[model samples]
Target: MNEFRIIEDLHRLQNQFASLWDPFVAAGGSVYPALNIHKGSDQVTITALVSGIDPDSLDITVSGNQLRLSGEVISGAPKSDLGANRVERFHGKFQRSLELPAEVDPEKTTAEFKNGILHLTLPIRESVKPRKIQVQSK
Candidate 1:
């Protein structure tokens, strides 16, 4: 009985902690457009899974070390006389911003959207790239 009580207390405490960290999960605001970032010595590449979004509606912004991706996910289902009985997919406007590992040159950045994926290749700023210095003999 004592062990069960302890387990119950721990579960309650975990719930409280989760609520404190992310109140949106309980509110049903799930994150969309998952991303993967890869950093190289001279450039950074970012790939985002944006399946249901229109390419024309997508916007990408880059400044220094910051990158912002914004777009809307539109449902293609035709309007039915009856309302949706079950809807599991997300459909709405979404904006997500990420900080790059290194400063990137916005002017040189390239973006491509193909087959529901957005690929970005940002070149690292020349000023921010590491340079090797040689030790001069006195």
Candidate 2:
């Protein structure tokens, strides 16, 4: 019974160690075009790493508080006879949708791609902006 307990504890310890590397590889196997977003009082800024993809192939859409990103990544296969033995890079059509913290104006939103990074600036809707009310005394 003592040996079984010891084995279980070891297994738990191994799992903890494995989780330490989770941040780097956790969503790596599945999620593509990872995003980083920043929200301010008047706007929201989003950044996504999209290396090795053509700018013309990307499509971005925004509706209310929802933002959609769709694109395709083409693989650069080698022409050598040896061919590829190990392939790890992601390639294909991928779409990711994110909900914004505040409603945004899609008409005013701007997208820029430079150095393999897609940067978006979405202005918060005028209706959603906070306004101050004046107080009256009798």
Identify the candidate with maximal lDDT.
2
Model 2: per-residue Cα lDDT over 1-138, one tens digit each: 345445545654543454445352365423467678899999999999898899999999999999988899887766675635555555667677767889999999999999989999999999999999899999
Clash counts per candidate, in order, are 0, 0
Q: On residues 1-138, what C-alpha lDDT tens digit does candidate 1 reach at each position? A: 345445545654544454444343365434456677899999999988888788999989999999888888887768766555555555667666667899999999999999999999999999999999999998
Where does candidate 2 stray beyond 4 Å? 1-30, 80-83
- Evaluate model 1: give its lDDT: 0.76
The lDDT for every candidate, in the order shown, is 0.76, 0.78
Per-residue lDDT of 78 in model 2: 64
Assess the local accuracy of residue 17 in candidate 2 as a C-alpha lDDT between 0 and 100. Answer: 52
RMSD to truth, every model: 10.0, 10.4
